[model samples]
Structures are given as structure tokens and as C-alpha cells.
Target chain A: MILQGADALIECLKQEGVEVVFGYPGGAVLTLYDALYNSQFPHVLTKHEQGAVHAADGYARVTGKVGVCIATSGPGATNLITGIATAYMDSVPLVAITGQVGVSLIGKDSFQEADICGITTPISKHNYLVKRAQDLPRVIKEAFYIARTGRPGPVVIDIAKDVFAATMDYEYPTEVSLRGYKPLFAGDEEVLRVCLEELRQAKKPLLFVGGGATISNMAPEIRKFVNATGIPVISSLMGLGVVPGDSSEHLGMVGMHGTYAANMATVECDLLLGVGVRFDDRVTGSVEHFAANAKILHFDIDPAEINKNVCATIKVVGDLAWSLPLFNKLVKDFAPDIKEQTASWREQTAIWKQDKPMTYKSREGVIMPQQVIAKLNELAEDAIVVTDVGQHQMWTAQFFNFRQARAFVTSGGLGTMGYGLPAAIGAQIGLPDKKVIVFCGDGGIMMNCQELATAADNGFPVKVIVMNNQVLGMVSQWQRLFYGERYSHTSLKGRTDYVKLAEAMGVTGFKAEHPGELEDILKKALATSGPVLVEVALPSDEDVMPMVPPGGCLDKMILGEC
Target chain B: MKYTLAVLVENRPGVLTHISGLISRRAFNIESIAAGHSEEVDTTRITIDVEVDDELELEQVVHQLSKLVDVIKIVNLTRVDHIERELALIKVKASKVNRSDLVDIVEIFRAKIVDVNRETMVVELTGEASKIDALCEVLVDFGIIEIVRTGKIALSRGPIAAKEM
Candidate 1:
């Protein structure tokens, strides 16, 4: 059957089970917007291209689906660069469709033309520049496949504007047969058995989980393994919520601002079982000293990750879906009771956890950021918490009690600022029944503040909490500690009012200047029907404690005030 | 240490960009790269030589390259019995008087003078990059003009293609 190119693209999206897309339309994508007018799937019109891409990324993280977004060529497509790089770093499954100039004018620097495919090449898993209308279905199919497969990432499909109006015999491909793009599901069982043997022989073992475990949804498997073996678990920042933080055996985050027990145990353990984690620099400070005494057993779906940063003594190079279940079976069949053998080690770690738990002092009538998060943890035990990068982000990671998988979403690998507002909106859209709360600092919130308009326009029930410290909290702390207290440009005091800003964007706004007012404002905000912003005043001199001091040993942390 | 990797990739537009882009993005030090269509109908063979400090780094480069969707296979030719060669075209400044001497030097190195003018001559050599370097080293006294080389390409000594392996 004959179809318009735009209709064919819409049909392709439907076949891929895409329920919605976020985008800002322009001249290049005029035909696509017209066709989308009649499609069953909804299209969200964001205030900016960056907001749209971030929304798509947040949607993907929570729903475990390939989030789709669209933009026009030139500046419109360029605006999506930061969001694309963010998705790439975090390995989010996304498909960004950018409308391009007509094929005849492609390289002539035509109006609204840009080489988006080339620009996104390094960041994207794969990208395509479709010059002909006939190639849409196949490329779209392959794009979605690549984005959602093993070690999922973003893929870009830049289509020519003329192709959208061109007629074609449209049909979506049922199967993708790329010779090079096969997702690994199973791996050598023999090596997995070797890993199990290593686990059995160790006196002290630690399970280090990362984003991969969460991305693969290995919560049940991890839970069973830890439960059966009584192994203490530590998590990377991105791995938060894969296992409930309340689990007695699970330590808090283990990195620069790692929990005392997790960092110390990493150095003293006889064996370290790394599940679905890359030894990122932020997690492995001073790689020479990281796990120096441990025989590492690395399990991941991507072979490239093994020995990429820290060498492993044994590796099970396969998806956790494959290796975790197999390892659990081996544990059930042949594992010995290790709880008695490592009782002393576990006791030491528990002592470390209890003795130096994350804490901050409260001043008279002043609200501390950690208290705000702790209150939320108690009030909204199951809320999906999102955050931008800063002191507020670390406070969220440290204080929040995540009981569910996909419950905490943030820009982990990229450490992107201005990610909270739009991402919270997308999370709310993906899970309408669940409460979505976002935290950002005064410095980061204004970077993409325009997204508040989108949230209000759609009537999305996302709670945005601004930790209104008068200065850039994290950088100022670094300056105070390391850079001779030259605050420089960090001060954000006496700036525009967040409440008025939120109200101007057509959303309800609230502010809590004192500690007593926080609980009331939080309750009112979360109970409200649509999007609401609450700015909680915080002392500017606060710091994320136990910072490992960049490039220093993880165990040699600078314990400030805490 | 320098390692040679023979990679088989899908014969599609932007596959080379994907391969080279990855190498540069990861900050892998690439010694040289050469690519062309292979025996297969829809495959391109790319040979990359990379310098790394350890075996682990080499493994990382290979694993990362294999992750590219267009890259079907990668074989570390440094580990196997392989035939390696490179083609180079060298230009040398010569007068009519010492042109015969230049010819004699080219003959000894198994190079041929592919082009000649009144002032300079172009020498064509197809052998290991080391062999071409030797020829150039010998001809330095003759005032060599310029040289261009297609970095090393290699293949195993059996019937199996790299992709099949």
C-alpha cells in the first residue's frame, strides 16, 4: 500500500510500541507534526529541545522502554546535544528523530540544515541520515532495535524534510538482521562456576552493584544471591534502589561520598563481586588503591567493561539476567553457609555503618537539606525521586530510602545539571499513579527553568523541591576546603524569587523559610493536583560530607562536620 | 607496544567514521589505519594499528571496536601468524646524471619508479612499512621530496577469513 513518508514514520513508531514522544516542531518537521495530529500516540510539546530530550531520557529510565523525541535541523537539533550526551553517558535507550533539509540542499548549508548525524556520532550508539523516503521504515526499525538492545543507548535518525512529503510503499520490517548487532544474553557457564568457587573460598566478600543491575532489572536475582549467601552489598550512585536501602546487608552508596563501611570494606575484603558495574573513576578513586586486596569477580553483559579500569581475577562476561540466575543456582546446589565464617567481617562493617552514619547539624530555625530528604523518605516511601547534580543530588542519594527498582533517576554518569524539572515531568507521565519528586539546587534549577512551563501546561503532577541555598553549594564547599575560600562567582544570594518564578510559569508555588514550615509545605505540595514547586531555604555553607577528595584513595575521605 | 587489528565491518556509509571516531573518543593512540572493500559482497575490511602500554589496553581497544554495530569481527593479527604489507609511493629529487643511481637503489629495495619528471621521480613500494622506511632511509641523500603510505594491512595464512574466525 502507498503511504506518505510521515504516515509511514508514525506507523513505524506504533509498531515499536511507542506510546508517546516529546518534541518541539519547526519548519523541517512540519509534515511530521501534521501527521502526528491524527495518530493515537500523544506528542508533548516542550518549551525547548533540551527539555524534550531530557523528558524522553527520564521516560526511558523509569519505564524501561525506548523513549522517543523529535527536533528540527540546525539550531533546533544542536539544542539536543547536551541531552543526547547525557543519555549516552548514562546508557539510556532513546530514539531522537531530527528532521533535516531536503536531500538536494543537504551539504549546501541550506537554511535550518546541520549535520546532526555527524555531530551525534560519537555520543549515539548509532545514527542515520535518511535521504530517501523508502529507507524510513528499515532505519526506524533498526534505530529502535539498537537503542533498546544490549547495553542500551541513544540512537539518532535524521530524516530529510522532503522525504516526509514523498510517497512510498511503506511497511515496517519484522526482523532486524544486522551481522554485527547481536545482544548477548548467555555466556560461558564454566567461567560462572569458577566465579562461584571464588565466592565460596573467600573469608570476606562484598557485592558491588552498579547501574547495569538496575538497567537489567536484576533485583530479584541480587536479592536471592545476597539472602542465600549473607554477603554485604554496596552500590554505585546509579545503582541506588536496585536493592532496598533498608536491607540490613545493603550498605549505602560507595564512591566519593561513599558510606564509611562500603569504602572501608572494599579495601579489606578478600573477594569483591562486581555485578553489572563499570569501575567508573568517581567510584574508584586512586585505581591503584581501589580493591587492592580483593580478588575481583566482574559480571556484566558488555565484554568491553571488564578490565577497562580495574583488572578482574575472574569474569563472567554476560548479562546479569544470564549469569545471576546461574550463580544463584550454583549457590543453592553447592554453596556452604558463609554467615558464620565472615561474622567478624560483617560485624566490623556494621560497626562502621552505625558509628559514622551520614549526618548534618541543624542551626536554629534553619532547614538542612538532608532533613528535607529524610522527611520525604518517611512521607513518600515509594515516591520516584529525581535530582540534578550538586549538593542536593548527593543529599538525595544519601538520605532517600529507595524500596523499589527504577525508583531513583538522576544524571549519574554525565552529572548533568538542569535535569530535574523536565525529567520529573517525564517520570510522572510514565507512571501516573506514582508520586514523582525532583530536587535541585538554586544554581542548577535556573539552567532549564523553562521546563516548569511545560509541566504546568500539561498539568503533570510532579513535585519540584528547590534546595534554596544562596550559593552554589558543592563548588563553594570545594573552594572553602581546597581553594582558600575564594568564593568567586558561587554566591547566588538575593536572586529572583523561586515562588514568584513558579507562579509566573502557571504553577502553584510555596516556600519554607524555617524548619517548622517544611513538613506542611511538603504535604500540601505532594497532595496538590498538578505541578507545584516548593523552595526550601537552606544554609549556604553546607557540604556533602565524607568526600573522598578527587584522585585520592577512597578510604582516605575528608569527613567534614559529619 | 603496537598491535595490528584486522576488522571486518558492514559495507555501509559512516562505518569508517564510527570506527575512527570510537578510537579517538576513547583516546586510544592509533598508529595507522587502512580500509577497503573485502571479498564479501557487503563487508569492508579495516586494518588498525594501535600503540598501547599493556595487553589489557589492547584488549580494551579490540573489545570496544567489536562493540560497534557495523564492526562484525576483529582479529588481533599481532597474536597470529599473518602476512603484513603496506604500499608507499615515494618521490625523490633527481637530475639526469644520478637518475641511474636512484634506479639502482630502488631495484635493491624491490621498489619501482612509477612516475618521473625532469626534477623528481615517484617510487612505488608494496611491502612492510618497515621496508618502505628502509628505502626512504637509503634515498635520503638523494633529496627525497615526499612519501605517502597506506598503513599496514594484514591477513592470516589459512583459508579462513577474519570474520569466520
Candidate 2:
């Protein structure tokens, strides 16, 4: 019944169903490492605390479960800040545990002692500093709950050294009671009625979906509403795959890199039905100019999100699962002729789609990124594709035809650079049966390339596809587009041999220089088992087209042909 | 303007450090902050009045606060229609010279004398933050020695609750 503090912590983690944790042990958390020596639970030791946290975040995002990370206090804990903030921005569930100084030495600022709890407070969903060993079990239980429930986010638990050494009879609590925290799931009916009335009266209605809708798995209902009412669906960067991009009613992604038709539709529509989206700046542009003509009807589970950015003419604070059904029933009852209005909208959208066709050219003797993406789609149709932030991310978005919810998880809001590999590892760990492929740029991959070791050690069969261009391709592309081609801080010099690096990390390495070699290398990476890295050298000049330059309108996008 | 913010966080260690660290890291000036748990859940309500340019900075602070691990929710109750309350125990000189004026001022503010000695009068008062400030300013003339004020705590007016609304 009684155990060492470190053993108790590990036991608590095992009870919470934590199969894998990403972390690096140091002086402050040495006891935990000692306990883990004889422990059964697996931990992926990352090169950096940042990588550890990110790997956990990736795991959380893909699995819809709480991702766990651990680090010693001081610099080790501080390094996790960026990763934790990244999770917080995108609403990923993560639980980060840090070792702290003894309770007696807490205020004295002893060696390796940092106020990690205070440092992580604003960035975490909730945090705890356990001074007494008796509090560890309850805090750990609460941390998991707080991290995973009601708009999931990262929760940090910083344990004092004394607590880790102290002995206590540990038992996990079944229920937690937090007076200050109680998030509402269902929306009010009166608000829903008002929203329905507005939808019924409107001629042109736009269904703007966000990541929240995808997370909630309300895409089926969203499709029903769009089909029944004939409203065109436009999604945010994070909202991709909520409404299938291939669907006739889908407007593709809206915002900076959005389709011309999607942006135009957002403006021309009379009623804007925003569902499960935060209306981020990249999507809205200037808040005053955004959806200027529309009377907005916002439906979200978070009440605070309503009127937070753009004001909603009729706000329905509830889950889309409930709201969409009611709206569908009301529209069917009130406007039987809604089909006629939708038909015209769909026809107009068709014309707009035809006008701006996404195209790319394959320079002879070189592997193009678009061609690689299209090839992966053909070969691995059902495989999960994850991408880091860069030109490759945009190219993947434009090329990949996603069919499932939670399939396209990227650091959209934060636009974190070193996101892909760890995210793919997380995705693979979360869905072990499913094939997880990470599409990362050379620059992005090298940022957190050390995670390759994490994947290799865990035996997680994650395929890392590196689109090597020998530069910070996205920023360079932006400079080419907007800054007169004077590339600054975008060039990545002395590119490391990715294959050798992969091999060193104890993973299978496959390299492709030509288009002909890509498919074989990709297949090799998929078949090799455990973790594999496939490096494909892309043409340096190739740019992610159909990009709306920053601070520019959607109409001003630079299409490849145009 | 320097504003006092009363935030309620979980009653766990590192919460205050988290709050103060966030303020310093964001380069925001914190005039004063005081925190402790309420009578309800193991929640530590912190009252921090920060001096910033406009409401935008405050809103940014609130957003940043919401992002924190331990911070559950934030309400700028100042803009909302609500009842604000603060408890301050002040030890003031109750000399014969300014005793009558102090008593008159205390009567108007509906304050109670909690402690009394030959040289000191510990006055306890509960009211809106600004009212307390005005009373404190008035009592400053009587040579106030020690002041312990429990920061602002608020409750929404009418049936429009934070959850239901």
C-alpha cells in the first residue's frame, strides 16, 4: 500500500492509462528516473524538453487523449513552455510534470530550483505544486481530468523534491470537484430558435466550420445541414476535412491561403453560420472588413468565444451536434423551397472553382513536392498524413484529399515550425493500427529532428517524409513573393545528410532524388517497420502557389498559372 | 491606469508564482496583487490591479491569464453589471483632535470598529472598491498605520449567470 514518492508517481501514471510519456530526466527529477529504471511504463527520452512536450502534444492531438511529458525543474521545465503554449493555442490535451526543489528550499532558489508552476500557469489549463506527498495522487488525478475535459489543454504538475522522497498511501480519486471550473456542453434553446429563424429568412447562407467542429465529429451533421439548406461550406486552416474538400458544396479553405470562391462567398453571403471556429486573424483579415455584409449566427460550445471577436447577430451557445439537427428540422418545416436557393449557389460556386484551378509543374530530373503529395494520396489513400509548418504544409493542404475528422492536425494558430515529426509520432502512438506519415520540410524537420530517436525507441511505425529543399522554404517563398527576393534568415546552410541522420537514430533511411525514386522510397519507409525516414530532395525554386500574401485580400492570391 | 485585479485560481503552490511570472514575462506593470482561496472549492481568488494603457491590454492580460494552466476563467467584472465587495481592516490614530471627523466619516461609510486601544482604532469596512478607496483616502488624514484589504470579489446581478448566459 505504501511506496517511494517516485514509485507512487509512476504508479499514478500507470493507473491513468499513460502507456507512453515523452521526457528527459535531470538532477531535480533524478529520483523519478531511478524509479523508472525498474518500471514497466515506457518513456521516450527527447533531446530537448521542447521536443518532449511537442511529442506529447502530437500524441494528444491525434489520440484525443491526454498527452504526458516530464522534465526536471529550472531550465528543463522552462524549455517546455513553448510546446505547452503551442498545445494551449490549438486546444490539445497535455499533462506536463516537472520536478521541483524541496519544500524548505522552494523560496530560497536552490540549485536546479525554478518556479515552474508559476512559469507555466498562464500557458497551462491548470497547474499544481505538490508540497506534501499526500497531495500527489489527488493532484495527478485532477491534472488528467483538467487536461482532457471541456476544451482540452495542457496541465502542469510541479512536484517538490521532498514530496517525491516522502511516502504516502496513494489512491486515485474517481471524481473531482472544482468550484471555479464547470464548462457548459449544451447550448440554450432560445438562442437556437433565434438562429434558426435567421437562417430561414436568409437567402445566401455560408457554413464556416472550424477545428472545434472537426474535434466534436459534427462533420456528418454539418454535411446534412449544408445539403439540406444548400449552403456552401468554407473551413478554416484547422477546419480542413470537416466538410470534404472534394464535395461540390465545400468552398475549400478560407482565409489567407483560402480559395478565391470561399473568401468571396464569405463576403457575399447574407447569413454567416460560424460553427466551432475561433475566427482567427489569418481567416478574418481585418476584423472590420471581415464578413462585412453578413449577419452572423455563431454556434459554439464555449460561451466566452461568442462576441469575443466578430459580433454574432444571433448566438447559439451549444454543441453543433444538437444545434444542427434542430436547424435542419426547422428549415425543413419552414422553407421547403430551400433546395432552389442552394442549387443556384452551388452552380455559382462551380463557376468560381473552374476559374481558379490549382496546378503545378514537375521540373525534369527533380522531385516536386506536389507530385510527391499526389503520389502519397494515390498509394496511401487511407493513411493519416501530418505536416509541419512550411511551404510543404500548404502544398499538402492543396493536394491531399482528406476524408476523415481529426485527420489533418497541424499547429494552425501558433504555426509552430518543428511540429511534424513529433506530431506524427504522437499520431502513430495514438492510432497504432493506422499508418502515420509526416510531410515535413528540411528546415522544419531539422528543428526537432531529434524526435526521430523517440519514434525509433518506442517501436512506433511512423514514416517521416522529408521534403528537402535546402532552405526555410516557406519563409523564402514568402520573401520571393512579397520582399523582392532578398532572402534573409531563410536559407539553411550545410544541410545534414537526412539518411545518415536517420540511420544514426536507429531508423530505416530511404533517399529519393528523382520523381521515379519517390514511390519506391516511400514504400520502403512504409514497409521497413518501427520508425523510418524517407528523404526526397525537392526543387529549390518551387513555391506553394495559390497563396494570398500576408495582409493581402483573397482575390490577390498568386495562383501558379495566374 | 493602475488597476487591481482579483483573480481566483486553484489553492495549490506555484499559482502566485505563475501569475507574477506571467505579468513580468509579458512586460506588464503590476501595481498590486493579493490572492487566497474562497469559501467554495479549493480555488485561490487573486486580486491584482495592474496599470496599463487601455482596456485592450487588460483584455490581453485576461486572454493570457485564461491560457495559464491553473487559471480556470477570468471575468473583467468591472465592465459587467455586478456587485463588488472588499474587506479592509485599518488601524488608524483615534486621537481627540481628529476623532470626531473620523467617526463621522466612518458613520457615513457604515464602517465598524473591530479593534480599539489607547493610540489606535482598527476600523473594519466592507463596500465597493472605490467607496473603500474614498474612505481610506479620507481616513489618511487621521494618520493610518496599517491597512489590510481583502481584494475585490464580485457577483453578477440578476439571473444572468456566467454559465447560463
Quote the lDDT for A58 in model 2.
81
Cα lDDT, model 1, residue A497: 95
Ten contiguous residues minimizing lDDT sum, candidate 2 chain A? A553-562
Model 1 Cα shift for residue A174 (angstroms) = 1.0
Candidate 2 residue-wise lDDT, A218-320, digit = tens: 7888877777767788888878888777888887888776777887787778889998898887888767777888899888766657666777888787667
Q: What is the lDDT of residue A190 in candidate 1?
A: 98
In order, the Cα lDDT scores of the candidates are 0.91, 0.80
lDDT of 1 by residue, A377-397 (tens): 988998999998899999999
How far does residue A265 in candidate 1 sit from its true spot (Å)? 1.2
Candidate No. with top lDDT: 1
Lowest-lDDT window of 10 residues in candidate 1 chain A?
A333-342
Residue B156, model 2, lDDT: 63
Candidate that scores best on DockQ: 1
